[model samples]
Structure formats: structure tokens, C-alpha cells
Target: MSDEHSPLIPASYDIVWSIVTVLIIALTIVALVTLARSARRLTATQALIWTVVVLFIPFLGPAAWLTIGRGGVPVERT
Candidate 1:
């Protein structure tokens, strides 16, 4: 019967969906937090530009910019 092959649900599907959702949430949190901290150090315009660029560009654009572009050397205040 069709019942034998009916597949509205599957264990693997649920597991994969859960993992994807968790990864998305984690990425969003990391992006927002990194942006927030960077905003404090960067000029208003720079921060805005970077934020938009990071969110819109696909794949490595966001992570690459955040990791290498923003990792500047620290300066001491007088």
C-alpha cells in the first residue's frame, strides 16, 4: 500500500532542520555582537557602511570583512 512509502515526515529531516536553525541563530548573534562592538570604535559612517555591506553580501563577505578588515591594532589614549 501507499502507506508503506508515505513520507510526510522523517527523522533525518527534523534533525537537519533543527541543526540549520541553530546555526542560523548562532551566526546572527555573532554578527550582531561583532558589529555592535565595532560600531563603538569606528566612525558613524564607517560603521553604517560595514553593517550594510556585511548583511547584504553572501557567504564569505561578512565573515571575511569582520575577521581581517576589522581586526585593527589598538591605540592608546592620551
Candidate 2:
């Protein structure tokens, strides 16, 4: 295809996508670490189930652990 007719991708857009991908990977790593720590605090069976969930379910697993599997509500801090 001629350069004029080919689809063009701006450099800035490519950089933005690269940055976003890196950020997503970093966040996933952080979530996995958090899940591991939280799992350690639970009983053996609970930890096993949570580990399975977090490892197999990707985003939803970690999110669930943070919201529903972290035991209970946090105390307010001033």
C-alpha cells in the first residue's frame, strides 16, 4: 500500500499504549503479592481456595480477595 493510503499510528499514541500496558502489568504484580500475603493470614483451606481463585481467575480473583475475602471492614482513621 502507498504511504498516503496506509493507516497511520502517531508516535504519541504508541507511547501512551506502551505506558498503559506497563502500568497494567505492574498493577497485576502488586495485586498478586497482596493476595499472597492475605492468604497467608487465613487458615490452610481458605488460603488454598483463595490461591486457586487468584491464580486462575486473573482480575476478578484479586479484586474479590480485596473486597470480599479480606475478612471485614476497616476502621476509620482521622
Clashes of each: 0, 0
Q: Residue 19 lDDT in model 1?
A: 89
Alpha-carbon local distance difference test for all models:
0.66, 0.68
lDDT over C-alpha atoms for residue 58 of model 2: 59
Candidate 2: pairs in clash: none
lDDT of 2 by residue, 1-78 (tens): 656432576777878988876765665576667766665467788778877876677567767776787655243355
Worst 10 residues of 1 by lDDT: 69-78
**What lDDT tens digits, residue by residue, belong to model 1 across residues 1-78?**
455543788878888989876875566557657777767677888778777766676435467555764676243375
lDDT of 1: 0.66
